[model samples]
Target: MASPQKTSRKAAGTRAAIRRARPASGRAHSGDAGDDIGLDALVGHAGYAVRRFQLWIFQDFIKTLATVDIRPTQYAVKNVIGANPGLSQMAVAKRLGIERARLVHLLDSLEERDFVSRIPSTIDRRSHALHLTTRGKAALAQFKRLAAEHERHVAEKIGKANREQLLRILACFT
Candidate 1:
């Protein structure tokens, strides 16, 4: 076995190397030895910054709605269904960019929760039209209130103006 003193020295050296590798903000910098290893390099990269921001926003949304047990995608699907009743499953899937098979499973879960209903479509007997249940309408209202609170948290973090600007810029991509 290695001596405790030797282990301590090894650990200390490892910690020091980590400190050197990380920025003052304590986030790990990703780059090769010759590259600038800090936020300066990361902030200049749009995709990386957007991904990091997306993760932060998603985590905040999940935490804020933990009590209601709604994820971001679920909330989005619910909102669309609530707003447009009798939309076909395919319509919802295409609108939200969810895969058809995946949407079927998602709809199944929502139906099991008594939050959504799938009725036989009059125009296309093979397809199911989506609708929110009475319970779902009530739950959606609660979800909206919670989502607004989450938005407020986001606004506080990035400022309302920046949030609005971010939305506008992101809208271009979608």
Candidate 2:
């Protein structure tokens, strides 16, 4: 009987022969065997593919926002302030999943742009309430329209049904 090593080598040789007998390609196919993992296996952990797709979507969004001179995070901040007037900075930070310090910086930029104002809360001097200035509101309205257009474009690319399912899945993750 053949040694186990010999048998394994023979089997591998037979497989290689069979592969070589098939059509030859112009592409060079030299690589370590471990490098040939399937896409699903490579990006399937914890929905890595989904995360990658989200990144692509965000890239498109950032490009769109660039035209309007607004960043995606900035739009998010403005929208939250628009929806929740008198919202506390801490509350905004908590709801938006932004760190308190980062939120402060974001608020500072908005304030500098005259897009938002921080007024002292009537109930607490330490906590400031947030409000959108008229300019801010107008800017938000424009952002909303642009966002709607971009959303529709993305939805068309991903299909309406898949878009709904994606939103549901993302909500569950968050």
Candidate 3:
């Protein structure tokens, strides 16, 4: 019979071998699976399949947003103003998570297009209140419709349930 010490060593070696033989569920190892690394390095080291899939999804969103002639940031600003009529410039900036100075430039562009107006605030004489013009409201409506269509398309690509779950996960991140 084998010595007890040798038998224990043999059992440990067999377990290690079994673990090594199993395929990993996460990122496949090209080499050095035990290497300690940061998230960026790990994502970078991952196979191209996952990265390509992510890029394709982003590309679709970019194309959809482009169709309305509004970038994602512009859409966000318009949505904030639409939702909060008579909101102060500072308030809108805060709600949209943009700097006051940057919001000014965005408001300027919208104002030039007659999509929005900044009037003296009734409550605060020192501040200007934001409002969407009829034109602005119409534009927002159009953009919203387009967004709905885009969302449907994406949902079709990835099931509606999955899209809802994705939104929930993203909300947690924000």
Candidate 4:
């Protein structure tokens, strides 16, 4: 059995250790040694910043698309196909920055879902033209509405002014 005074001292020491471990400013400071877990150059890196923003937006995207059951990439593909009926598969792939091989597989999935159809091009026998089905049009409409809401939410989060500036900066790279 320990004395009350020794127990009090031990409790006091534990509190002091916790206070030392956590800095007053909230973020933990690396003591004399260098093991600070802080955003050093990651905050300054453009790719890292974009990836962070993408992750943030994608979380919201997942929630918004849950009812619709379509991913952002799928929505984009449907949008392009809906807008540009008779567009070549290669053209869609190029515009989306996707490879032809990958786009073919993606198209296969959409076709299986009956969202899109690939017709042999009259002008180019080697190419297949893309078209969106009635179902795809409905999904694209829902996606556009959800996407607009997402855009507004993101703008509110980052501030409209900052969002515009950030968009301009991002556009320069693209």
Predicted model with the maximum lDDT: 1
Tell me, by TM-score, which candidate is best: 1
In candidate 1, what residue range of length 10 has the lowest lDDT sum? 34-43
Q: How close is candidate 2 to the true structure, as a TM-score?
A: 0.74
Looking at model 4, the pairs that clash are none
* Candidate no. 1 TM-score: 0.77
Residue 70 of model 3 has an lDDT of 71
- Give Cα distance to truth, residue 11, candidate 2, Å: 28
Better of 2 and 3 by lDDT: 2
Taking the tens digit of each residue's C-alpha lDDT, what string does model 2 give over 58-163?
8878777777778778898899999999999999888889999999999999999999999999999999999999999999999999888779878988999999
Per-candidate TM equals: 0.77, 0.74, 0.64, 0.74
How do the candidates rank by TM-score, highest first?
1, 4, 2, 3
lDDT, each prediction: 0.88, 0.82, 0.77, 0.82
Pairs in clash, predicted candidate 1: none
lDDT of 4 by residue, 1-174 (tens): 889999999989876655554454546465635333344445447888789789999888878778877777788889889989999988998888988898888889899988999889999999888999888787688889988888898998899999999889778655
- Candidate 3 residue lDDT tens string, 1-174: 999999999999976654554444444456646532223333434455347656766576668878667756677788888888888989888877889999899889889988899999888899998889999999999888877877888799889998898788668545
Tens-digit per-residue lDDT, 21-85, candidate 1: 55676454565464335554544478987898889999999999999999998998999999999
